[model samples]
Target: MYMVLVRTRVLPGDLLHDSYTGIAPPNTYKLGNKLFSLKVGLVEIDGKDVKLIPLAGPYIPRVNDFVIGKIIDFDAFSWDVDINSIYTAHLPAQDVFGREFSSQTHSLTSQFKVGDMLAAKIIAFDRTKDPVLTVREHGLGKIVHGEPIKLSPSKIPRLIGKKGSMAKIIETKTKTKLIIGQNGIIVVQGPSEGIVLAARAIHLIEEKAHMPSLTNMINELLTKEV
Candidate 1:
């Protein structure tokens, strides 16, 4: 089995596997032993399973992707969250109530309601299925008092910087703690003035993510008196 991750743009009907690999994953179809892509996307080969990541469009949920979401609606079993994506995600009652989960008796509103903000991770997702979220990991849960900022998901890597250099500079200068969501949502926790400075730097990074060597530019921004 090839363990290499093949990351290349593939168009619809592109040949993915010539022989039996595994069941065709979402966005792909299998005809006998041959597999083919069903859409234009970036391909990822997981064991023998092929997965696609959209090249252009709104945010598509991927497992392990940390995201910030706002609770939009709820039912007896789960809370529906809007992660600035096409479909609303869900945080199940079992995820919150643990072994004692009982949608009939346990109140979902007592834990979260519409308009509540949360820091969660996508535990399960398929192009055809709604994303599933969980806050069981460390540093994941309700977003407390802080300034929330939004940016394009494509610019997340630049915001983090090489080895986190860019993010470090903003934190050191503003004396703030940053909670980053790969889905483009961010929360800056610090003094009011520091929060402003941090946000300024973040937006500057977004505007100039294509530019090389941003540390110096950020240094200048932080040093400039507001």
Candidate 2:
């Protein structure tokens, strides 16, 4: 695989790699023997594949992506949640409290008041329908406390780093727990000072995601924060 420098600006139609070198992945298209970029962003090469990492774009919901959402509205059996996307996600009562809703005995508002924030997973979604969300999985539920920090959705993987190394470092140094939502919301929890530091670190990652040696830079920042 050919290695391109991190943060290398790739414009639409820019030659990323020849067909003989690597397969064209997302954000790229192949034309005859050449792979070209389809977006203006940084280059990422994985094995024998080449793709562009978009610098800006709207979040498109995908199944199984953990997300943080705010309760927006509610009906008899489901609640509308703002998942920081163009599409509002729906969380059925059954998916939340793990039981069918009974009008005589259950009240959705009592469980999830409007504006309440929760961490959930996208259970289903398609272009033709709204996304369905669930908080039934372990470690998925109400975010009782913490500050919510938003970042560009495309920068999530860089914030997480390889195998979560960057996240682990920030958590350890700041003495905080970071609940990262792929939808771009991050909950930072710890002592007031630690939470502040962790939030800063997360923003740093978002701003410098495409830079080289970002992990080391974040590590240094965390060290100084301590």
Query: Which residue pairs come into collision in candidate 2?
Result: none
User: Which pairs of residues collide in model 1?
Assistant: none
Candidate 2: which stretches are off by over 4 Å? 1-7, 18-24, 30-34, 45-48
The alpha-carbon lDDT assigned to residue 53 of candidate 2 equals 88
lDDT of 1 by residue, 194-213 (tens): 99999999899777665556
Question: What TM-score does candidate 1 get on C-alpha atoms?
Answer: 0.75
* lDDT tens per residue, model 2, 142-161: 89999899989988888888
- Clash number by candidate, in order: 0, 0
lDDT assessment of candidate 1 = 0.83
TM-score of each: 0.75, 0.89
Range of the 10 consecutive residues with the lowest summed lDDT in candidate 1 = 49-58
Top candidate, metric lDDT? 2
- Specify the highest-TM-score model's number: 2
